[model samples]
Each structure stands twice: as C-alpha cells, then as structure tokens.
Target chain A: MKNNNKKKIKIPKGSNILEGSRAVALTVANIEPDVVSAYPITPQTHIVEDLAKFKADGKASYEYVRAESEFAAASIVVGASATGVRTYSATSSQGLLLMTEVIFNMAGLRLPIVLTIANRGVSSPITIWNDHQDAMTVRDAGWLMFFAENHQEAVAQHLLAYKLAETLNIPAMVNIDGFILTHSYEPVIIPTKAQIKKYLPKYSPTKGSYLNPKEPMTMGSFARPAYYQEIRQSLQDDLSNSIDLIEKEYKKLQKTLGKDIATKDSSALIEYYGKKKAKTVIVAMGSVVGTIKEVVDENKEVAVLKLKVIRPFPYKQIIKNLKNAKKIIVIEKAISLGNVGPMASELKSALQGKTPAKIYSIIAGLGGRDITKKKINKIININSQDTNKAIFIS
Target chain B: MKEIRVHGRGGQGVVTASEIIAISAFKDGFFSQAFPSFGVERTGAPIEAFARIDTNFIRTREQIYNPDIVIILDASLLGSEAVKSGVNNNTKILINTTLNPQEIIKKYPNLKNKQNSLLTIDATGIALKILGKNLANTVILGALAKQTEIITLKGLKQAISEKFSEKNQEIVKKNLKAVSIAYDK
Candidate 1:
C-alpha cells in the first residue's frame, strides 16, 4: 500500500513553505529591528506569537514587548521609533481601530515605525476574517500602505516597507489579507542575514529626526491656525513624493537581489497582467488579484491591473493602464456603506473625464466570503454585456 | 492541480494534516498551498482545511469548491451537511473509520457511484495502537497517499519526521509506524 512512486527529492536550501504571518514575522526578525510591541488579536495573533517564539529561540535579538492593548502597542512602537531605533508591530480589525489615535500620531510625528495591518472585517456583529475595511478605515491616516498579493510578496514587502519607512521618515503599514494571507501556507524564499545586511543597512537616524536628550526637540507640537494647513499639506506632498522613493528602493532591491521584486513596469506602481490592449480589465488590491490573474490568464479578452500601493493612491498609473479598455471592473472586499467601495469611488474619480472606459463597481467577499473564479468570470460577463455602477456579489 | 478538503473538529490536527500534505507535495517537487477555514475556533467545532498541489505555481487563493479528494478525519461528521457539499461524481472520499467502504457508500446513497471511490481506514485505531493517542491526521495522510498517489509515502514520512524532529525521537517513530500501519490497511 506504500506509494510506489516514491523517489529521492532534494529540498532547496533557504526555501520553505511558510505561513504568510510566519513569513512576515521571520522577515521582520531578519531585518533585526530594535523593538517589537504587539497585542494578540485573531488572525494577527500568530504574527506576534511567532515573533515571541523567535525571541525565545534566539533567532532574533529584538526587545519583545507584549502590550496590554493595541493602543498601548502602538504607543510603545512610537516611543521606540522616536528614540532612533527601528520598531515593528502588527494588528487587525478592532485592534487596528483601537490603535487609530496612535496610528495618526505615529505618522504625524514622522516616527518611521513599520506596522503590519492583517486586514480583517470591522465588527459589530463580530467577524474575524479577511477584508480591506480595517485598512481603508485609516486610509487618510498619513501612513503609507502597501498591499501584498501573496505570502512571497508579504515577506518581500516587509523588507521594502522597512527600507522605505526609514528612508522617508514616514510610518509604513503592510496590509496583508487576514486569514487569507495571514493563515495560508505557501512556499517562500527567505532572505539570509547576509543578504539583509547588504540590502538593508544598519539603522542610523538623521540628527533632526531622532529624539536625543542631548539635543532635545519638540515633536507632534500644537500648530497654530496659520501653520496647521501647511503641516497637513506638507505631509500630503511628502506621501505623494514617496512614490519615487518607493520605486527607487524597489529597483535597488531588484539590482541587489538580481530578481524582479516589484511590478514589471519599472516606473508603474500598479502591476498589469494579460494582454496590454485587452478591452476589459479588472482592477483590485491584495490577494484577490491572484484569483483574478488565474481567470485573466484563461480569457484572452480580459486583463488585470493589481494595485500594489494603495495609499498615495496610484492614480496616474491606474488611469494609464485602463485608458484603452472599454470596460473596467473594480472588485472590493469592503463597501463604503452609503457610497460604493472606497477603492471603486477612487477609481471612478481618477477615471473621470480621463478615460472612455465604462467603470463598474462590484463589492464581493465581505467578511470572509469566497471570491471564486466562477464569481469573477460572472462579473466579467455581466460587465461586458452592460455597465453596472455598483453590483453587490452575495 | 489536485485540490483536497479535510473535515474534522478542532484539536484533531486537521490543519496540520493539510500542512503535512502540502509539505510532502512540496518535498516531491510540486508547488503546494494549504489553509484552514478560520471559522469559530472552539474545540470540537466542525472545522475544515484545504490543500492544493500542482506542477506549476498556484496563484488562486479561493477555497477549493470542488475538491478532487476529501479526507474526513472525524467519522462522526459524516452526516453533516458541510461534509456533503462540493462532492461530485469524480470526487474521492477517504474517511478514517472502521466501517467498510461499501457500508459508507451505502450509508451516503447520494455519494455512491461507479466513478467515485470511497475509502475507509481504521486510522484512529491504528493511532491508538501505535502512538497511544487518537492523532489520526498522519495516518489518514498515509491512506491519502495510497489512494491519490499525489505524494509518495516516503515524502509523507520525511515531512512527518521533520515536523516532529523537535519532539522525542520515540514519538516520531511511533507516528511513522501509525502511518505505515494505516497505509498497509
């Protein structure tokens, strides 16, 4: 009864089939951050638990702080980051909501703290599953957000997130689909310590950015009416300008690692797959893009534009990618209540008067509902026949 | 691509079974992915996990709606509606039970057919005899390897040994014995 087909197989070194949360955690540990503060929440609990295990096993040398609450966790990282040390934390759903006040402060003060938002559904009836609602809630919190489409990207993006955050002095959050990405196990190539050292050098803070007791300076100060608008505007401008820096680091990573880590288009923030001139293109973020790509590969008429970076919303790249398409379908895991999906609304506004493609918004996979290939194909079929402004796939 | 769905209650190592299958497939030079249902996680609650194995990379993140193979770790869950869903004519049912395969086919008349294959193994009994516990996940995996031929028994043994390498060597050997016993059955 034994499997007669058994043969000798060699597992390649440095490659492992790792859970997405564990991959991200291991990547964070490889970066050798100074401190990690976190509180356990469903879907996100494994991340902090893994980090704690890493510390216990002597795999990492960072100070691990088990905070009382998400708010306290956020505060602890902020303090750690302000004192000129690389810091990390992760949360989801209510935890992300609880840390909202500190989330803003971390960005407002330009603390360069990196966090992982294991994107989950916001609760009232209570659900712990995949959705973008949690991350979308803090879309305007001034933190740069990057959505990973899979476990490999989830690991690679953490290294990129830390590099980008420290380089720009802006807080960065990597949004991974809770349970979907966080709980899933897939093969990933983890960067070695030597590779990390060569790629992401030691953290040396610029003089004005760090909170040194020797040269004490005020941060998160109360701005007067005259300076308030300017401060907000400056943050906005800096976020927008970060696209260049983000692309630069991505390219540098490609050169250093000798692999194309980012999208194929060196300059584009959005990754396009399928025929470039396909009449119909589906636009999405996070893990859903994987499913879309599978369907897109089968259909010659369909294409996909995956949004890698959500904040500093890649308007120009998105518009450019969809300009020639006759139909554009925006799939979202979260709805904006009274309005359409947050992403769909943004896409519509970005495409206003810019492209002739009729835009359709489809809200699917809310609170852990599966977005199967059949559902995606159905959406494509429906959108092809006639334009639907907002269709809820239940 | 081969998709598999595992049904068992919480604390039954259902997720671990899927992971081991995936790891075994990976060890055999195939791309594999595994994930749990992430439902209410209370112990004894019906939980499911999924696995996909293919020659090429698996890009889709969707749950396996039409699994080629379904492994039932808990025989008590056989009558549940959740276990009945997504089963088609070509689906293979591998259950950890002492009942005969024909008996199971007769019990679930809707699932019986000429094309479909229903398999049963006393994995729980084997686990209790060899490992002194009711951990049938690895034993069921051995039966799955024999039925599907998706991963080799050698691959499964390697994965099981590596998984329990941190634990006592005696325990790892006992688990391997359980897998061997279930495979022979």
Candidate 2:
C-alpha cells in the first residue's frame, strides 16, 4: 500500500472487518494523541506503519516521529507526556526489552502515557513469535497492564486504558499476543472520532504535575532513599486501588460506545467462560484463552478463566472465582527461565492454603507454536490423573 | 462454520487473499476470522493463511487442521505435502495452474481417486495479461466465487475494491477486471 494516492472513503457506522493492527491504529487516530514515536518490530510493525501511513495521508493529526531506536522512541513519548501531551508508542520482544529503562522511567515519573506491547518471545535462538515473555519481563514496572483476547477487546481496552491512565496519572501497557492477535483479521467496531472526543476528551494534567512554563518545578529529579520507598509504595498502592477505577472506566466506555464494544459479560480484569461448576478449569491469558474457551465449550466438565489484567495480578479475583474447582490448570506461553511459568507461580502464591483445587502448570505454545484442540484435550486428559509436576506440551 | 486454508509463497499476497475472503464473508452477514501462519520472513518461502466463516462469533485462534476448502495460489507448491495434508475426499481444492482437473490428477497420481471437487485456473497467465503482473492472489478469489457459492461475486468485488481503494484506482480497476475474467472462465 503506497501513500501517493490519498483518497478517503466514507466508512459506515458499523463493524468494519479489519486486521487487528489496522483497527487499533484507527482507534488511536480517533483518540488524537499528541505524539506517536515508534520503531517497527514484527507483529508490532504493522501498527506503527499504519499510524505512520495515517500521518502521511493527513488522516492522523499527531506528530509521527521516526525514531532511530526503541530507546529513543520510548524517550520521545516520555518527553512528550512530561510536557502534558497524550503520547503513544508500541514495540515487541527485543524492542520492548530495549525500552525497559524508559518504560520504568515513564511509570516512575507518573506520566499517563499508553504503550502497546505486541507481546513476543524474547531472544536466545532468535524467534519472532507470540509469547508472554516480553510483557512478563516488565510485569512489576508499575505500569497498568492489560491483555486482550481479540481485536474488539483490544480496541475497547485502548479506549478504556487512556481514560484510566489519565485519571490516575499512571502509565499503561496494553499487551496483545504478537502475531496471534496483532496479525489476525476480525470484525471490529472502532469508536468514531466524535465518540472518542466525547469519551476520552483532552489531556489536561493537574497544576504543577506537568512541565509548564508558568509553574517552574523540577520533574524526575533524584528522589533520596528517604522518600523513594514511599514513592514506590504510592505507585503500588495506586495500581492496586485502580482496580475499582478500571471497572468504572470500562463501564463508562461500554455505556458510551454501545455494549458490543465491551468484552461480553465480563469484568475489566478477568472473564469467566464455560460451565461454572466444572471440575477442571484452565487459567490463561492473551489469545490462547480463545482456543481454550473453544475446547471448554465441547467438554461438559471443564471451564476457562481468561485473565485480562496481569499487572495487578488480580490474585484476589482469581481466588474468588476458582475456589470451588477440584482441579486448576495454569497454561502459559512464557516461563521464568529457571523457575515455573510466571502466571502459574503467582497463582500458587495467591492460592496457597486458600483453595482445595489441585493446581497444575502446563506450559505450551512457546515461540509461536500452535496450540491446537488436540493439545488442549491432552491437558484435559492429563488433569484427570493427579501429578504436581508442570507439563510441557511439545 | 466453514474453514478455508490458502497455500502460497510469501510475496503472493496469500495473507491478503485470506483476509479478503473473511471480509467478503463478513460482508455477507457472517462472522469471520483470518490470520496467517508464517514460516520464514522472506519472499518465495511457502506460507499458509487461514479464514474461518461462522454464523456465530469465532473464538478459536488455532491454525486450521482440516479445512473444508483449500486454495493453492502457486502451482509449484502443488507437489508439497502440505497441499494434501488434511484434505479429505469431500474437501474442495482450487489450484492456480493451467492444468485441467484431470491433468492435475494425472500429474499427481497420489491425489487419490476420491469424490473431491478440484478446480484449476491459469491465474498467473490471467494476472499477467490483465494486471500486467504475476499477482494472482485476487484473481484466484474470482474463480472461488464462481465455482463455489461460499462467497458471492458482489461481496468479493466490494471487498477487493475496499482493499485496493487505498492504492491507485487504476490498480483496483485492473485487479477487478482480472477477477471478472477468471470468474467468467
């Protein structure tokens, strides 16, 4: 697609079947961010490229900066956000890893910037595939994290993320499993520019919060050891307390942009599917939850717990939902290198002596490997017999 | 629900064809999902893309194992094992080659004498003649629309126009002509 011929078509007010990246880009354009600086990486490449194209064709009003590196891209967003502008950036895998330092800086400085992580596997053997490793690497960076099951939810999350992040003055990362969700095409109802303007409004920081000419106050100055602990505690406290605000913003977006825009009958943090009293339950995040939900639909005795929010961990919600299950299976795409799956480990810590459900960690679909129905059924079959060991489905 | 798998080389716009199929299905008031299963990141490398059309919402993100319809955009890939991997007797197979159905079966005797419906077209020749290029991905969709009622020609044309509408209108015109020529063939 070249940008030489710039002709606009009137998109009807309904679902437009589009690739996930394109839908997201359109939504971002409607949101009307002040700056979008990103270095392209596969899966994430389409998104930045689309946004760049929009800027080139005069469809987007934001300044699309062609950054030299991911680090520079992250730095650009941070700088723009500090000056009280709604800024956006996106990356995947190694690109994300490169942006780690700036990622934490954005959060610590209390910049309400939104970044999209087209989640991908990390290096070592060098694979360009979908996995949770990249997102999991910065799980505790104090940024509000969200995992979308599909394109619609992804669009909804972006709309809601901006509202919540701006309200709480915190950074956010919306993680879409690379390739799986980013490359897939589906019918998505992106909010119109008018709808977004009415919903998100404009970015106006509180007095003295941003770097303004009238208010001369040092920003991101070195915090001494005396106050650093409390500052960190404040971020932790706000992130944990933002649970209620997230739900509130989610409901607001749903009410503002029809019910179809929201993930059907689910909270902003988690979504439960399949039989409520099923003996076996599978817990996972990202697009894999969709496959598990399909398998659960056929099996009468299995359920699925789709974790949408990973930053807050949602441990209390996870425990509240899985208290009755006889067996719990934690399926994840990323492992903690030497230890168990990050999500499984967190679940065990959260559910210790809390639920009688025997928890099993099953790691599969590493480096873009397909998670088929047969493999899901294999997890079901393995759960029938008791074993505390983690199962890796090859 | 109907599952369609497309087999082609990287630069052949295999992923775009699958997306157009999904868009056409969506245009016809069906829920659809389309995605590609990439191998290597280079042109001419064999790749597979999939499209699923269902009356209900599509939830599964797994690659298609047993597709009801299979499309081959490159005749050179006809000899690959992947082309016939999950094909059953009832599977509808479309190939972009000049060989007729009988000639194709004769060349690849292992296609098994089953009740499978096979259709072939010289997509390359048609694309070269009309579009002045060897991009036959969209041309194959016209044959698919004509032979099978899986997707309507009107819906396919609308989807094609929408896809290429961002590009030069001349390209869209030529591609639409190629599709019509293949449809009439």
lDDT top scorer: 2
- TM-score of structure candidate 1: 0.95
What local lDDT does model 2 show for residue B13?
93
lDDT of 1 by residue, A205-273 (tens): 987778899999978899999899998888899999888788888888767754523223454267899
Question: How would you class the docking of model 1?
Answer: medium
Question: Cα lDDT for residue A190, model 2?
Answer: 86
Q: Specify the poorest-scoring 10-residue window by lDDT in model 1 chain A.
A: A1-10
Residue-pair clashes per prediction, in order, are: 0, 0
Over B84-143, each residue of candidate 2 has an lDDT whose tens digit, in order, gives 888887789999998887888788776747325788889999999999989999999999
Q: Which predicted model would earn the best DockQ? A: 1
- Candidate 1 backbone collisions, by pair: none
Instruction: Record all residue pairs in model 2 with backbone atoms less than 3 Å apart, i.e. clashing.
Output: none
- Model 2, retained fraction of real contacts? 0.60
TM-scores of the candidates in the order shown: 0.95, 0.96
What is the CAPRI rating of model 2's predicted complex?
acceptable
